[model samples]
Target: MADPSNYTYPSPLEGYEGLEPLPDEKETEGPNAKAFINPPSKTLSKAYNQFADPITNDTRGGFDIHIYYLQTNASELKFAAELHERIRREFPELRIYRLFEGPVGPHPIAMFEVNVFTPQQFGAFVAWLVINRGPLSVLVHPNTGDDVRDHSQRATWMGQPIPLQIGFLKEMLKRKEQEGQTNGS
Candidate 1:
């Protein structure tokens, strides 16, 4: 993870909070504020960013995941509970899954975003999704402020993660067998 200290303060988020999005038509600015096209609004803004995520890709090639969730009218806690149950029953391989229901009011759209380790994991997730799927993929925006990623943090644990469970003796024995075979010449 890149050090939060390394970043310039008042992240790109600060300006966004009060920003009212322009209409899909051509942007017209106020007499003082100039209008510019938000490229993300125009083009599908799909650049990989690694400064804040797992995997060692230089933003573009890094292992990244974002999943979008939308609810018409929901109790976040209840939704999270139901989401957890679905994971446990449907996709057990996804050992740790998380859901975040953001603060309500003003911003009316309920932003439910989930992040996981790998694409394989997410694919499995989609397969097991019993309830909701939306057109949007989860996106990780640049972090600003105190900078702990509370919204997208992990939430559910289906089971123990799969790991290569080789004993020390097994590893040593395998190595010795390889050595002995090599020396037969």
Candidate 2:
């Protein structure tokens, strides 16, 4: 076998020249400076807008952290119970929902839902979960107005991905759209 240190990997963008060249520092003086001096909005960061003084929009505040464990396994159930209690004890400010004994909503396994309203909470909780969530799966998804998209497309999984029953969500969305049409006309 060849020496691994002697081999060099080719750049992914080596042959790809489809993008435009970046502007020089001098070219971004007037408009950029004016914009920086006077921002479009008072709160430009999504973190602030979503949590503090949230603007009425499609997406909701913060994210949902679903901790799923196998109800069949005795050890996993005990661990999940301990984890749930630990989370409640540690992050008392967070809106931690009641633990479900069986599958509920789109979730296919026994799990507990925790709602974090701020970016700080989101970061801290997720980081903690990363280290502590052993032999358990987590589904972290944003509460975008569109539940189907949020649960399906925008979901982030920790460990193995659990199959979600989002068909009901799709039907719910369709019914809502139909109602909106009927009300408008």
TM-score per candidate: 0.26, 0.66
Best by lDDT: 2
TM-score of 1: 0.26
RMSD of each candidate relative to the true structure: 15.8, 12.1
lDDT of each: 0.39, 0.77
Residue 58 in candidate 1, Cα distance off native in Å: 14
Native-structure RMSD, model 1: 15.8
